[model samples]
Target: MVANLDASSKAGSVLIVGAGIGGMGSAQLLAQMGYKVYLLDSAPGIGGSMHLLDRTFPTDSCGICIMSPDQPSYCPTLECGMHPNIEILSYAEVESLEGEAGDFRALVKHRPRYVDIIGCNNCGLCVEVCPVERPDDHEGRLHEVKAIYRPPTRAVPDTYVIDMDYCTRCGKCVEVCPTEAIDLGMAARRSEIEVGAVILSPGYRAFDARIKGEFGYGYYDNVLTSIEFERMVSLTGSTQAHLVRPSDGAAPRRVAFIQCVGSRD
Candidate 1:
């Protein structure tokens, strides 16, 4: 998945390895400074882990909304996609880095999304016709979605991606797509890009609650992870913001929060 960089292409270019808030913000700032910015992320769409949060701490504001007086409705994630100087490489990861401080070559590997992002209009016809269904990982597997599905509500490059693991390759989505955007035979790609600088903003991974078996994260029906709880309370979550027990639909009369279960070790 590695490729040789073209020497002539190296200039005032920057590569930001992650499409979270920090990465997207950096890309926009650099692009404004007249630099060609490449925003790379290993997800179906941008927005990173921020897509999981219902609200931010301290202020308790919506996580996705970037408030600004000039444009109060501005969304940074969506803006990154529209930036002329910025090229978003979603569903991709940097495999290797070469060269020196001033000029560097990055070998990037892109995973196959199957669905064409540009050709697909987010019509959801592919999703409607697809017979395969899987637990929605974005929603903490609390709900189900078709084999081909969109990343999130406000994901940049808003389009559907096929979960090849769950897909039976029945070709129902390709047949029903009005835009003919689906391709089950799509293959992964690799590219080498020249950049003046590289910024790493790979976000944090939530602690796996299953590691501490005492809490019975997967074994017990009532047990839940912090992320699971966050998704449960989210307005876009399974219950549509209503906090309820996973074991049963009824709202729990009592709740408990354990602090630092896998930390301070």
Candidate 2:
């Protein structure tokens, strides 16, 4: 038996707490059902951990090329950005939540990207002028990038973001930018939003292999994490798909894969 519930009585908005594949998928579905979705993420851009991968398991397919129903050429990440019902709130986190299921209030804290998403045209000029260089986290620190850079190749809101930690406030990028989008003094913002429901999809974090000193993750030059190995062989990675030893440019004669390093514990 179906209960004839009044559709007008319930709120029509949803707050999705993560912007990973799972959260993105959920947001797209909800938005299709005539609900407004607020896709919030702590990173400067969306795609989550999956964004760092070269290929997926079993099928060995590109991890970022998620199929979209509306646009065959666009991935879900890009689709979410273009969708009218979905509002991407990147570089933000949920501070608090209150109220009942149908009528909920959330306090969201947003971190400054230090670059205007809509203003910047992603011309790579800022990256060329900026003097500061930092280890690229996306490549497992195997490569270096300018302080101001895109999170990934195909990141949504596809704009440059400043790594405030490494930024020297040199003002070189500011002078060279054609659109005047670089801002070193930008400040964080906070907001309170009302939503009909809350969905928590905070993804998993990679285990720190350094804790297990026996593996020599940090000490040995040849030692590599699963992510590092994946990046090393990735076609778009630092080596351009060439599998070579980190200590030297030579191809490895033999390799060992240790399964269940953190999981077994």
Candidate 3:
């Protein structure tokens, strides 16, 4: 059941899972109306599908301009970093849930950022010093992310995150940062909260392009998925909105669009 969008009663808080567009919209509207809202997400950042895009379709609106710096399109969990009513739980997952419909207790585990999200200034300095670069899923193979970096250009909480999986503990980012926000040995934290209602807004996944082997997907650099093409065409996208062939970095003259590669089977 959809709760009151603007109900301003601290009697029962709303717990929202998945800080996608839907989750953010719900949280925004609810908080605007005076409701005590708790936005939760397993990912380190928010904005979900929107974060990966360089621009929105049809109008080509700048996605970065559409989001608030206070409440980043990325890192929805930290939305409350600026708000007094909202609490953002970043790098955290719900470990346990109990109680009846109106009242529930949720155990959450917040993974370490290694770097302090609050102190880091979101400067690209550390990013430049870090030698390791990884495939940015947001950029669709177009851009590379540093070992310690934000999800995107204007990430919320203006903090740095340690790509724990790839971090070699080189300490270069920590050494170069002017803020000294890098904490190499931070550990995961756990906490619990009570809420009156829970909202589920799990977003849809992009259709995988690999299933259509006929397109020469990974084998052919020229071939790309619709989403990848969209990213290529986006300004905020990894290519910074430059469209080019993956193999030769040359513009394409003849492009083909195949609609139902994985769906409608």
**Highest lDDT among the candidates is held by which one?**
2
Q: Which one wins by TM-score: 1 or 2?
A: 2
Runs off by more than 4 Å, candidate 2: 1-10, 66-73
36-74: candidate 2 lDDT, tens digit per residue = 789999988888877777677776866766433443436
Which 10 consecutive positions of candidate 1 have the poorest summed lDDT? 1-10
Badly placed stretches (over 4 Å) of model 1 are 1-10, 66-73
By TM-score, the best candidate is 2
> Over 4 Å off in model 3, which ranges?
1-11, 62-83
Per-candidate RMSD, Å = 4.2, 2.9, 3.8
Rank order (by TM-score, best first): 2, 1, 3
118-227 per-residue lDDT for model 3 (tens digits): 78777778888888888776666656787777765444444678788888888888788898888898999999887777888878887767777887887787888887
Residue 8 accuracy (lDDT) in model 2: 38
- How high is the CA lDDT of each candidate model? 0.82, 0.83, 0.72
Steric collisions counted per model: 0, 0, 8
The estimated TM-scores of all candidates read 0.89, 0.91, 0.86
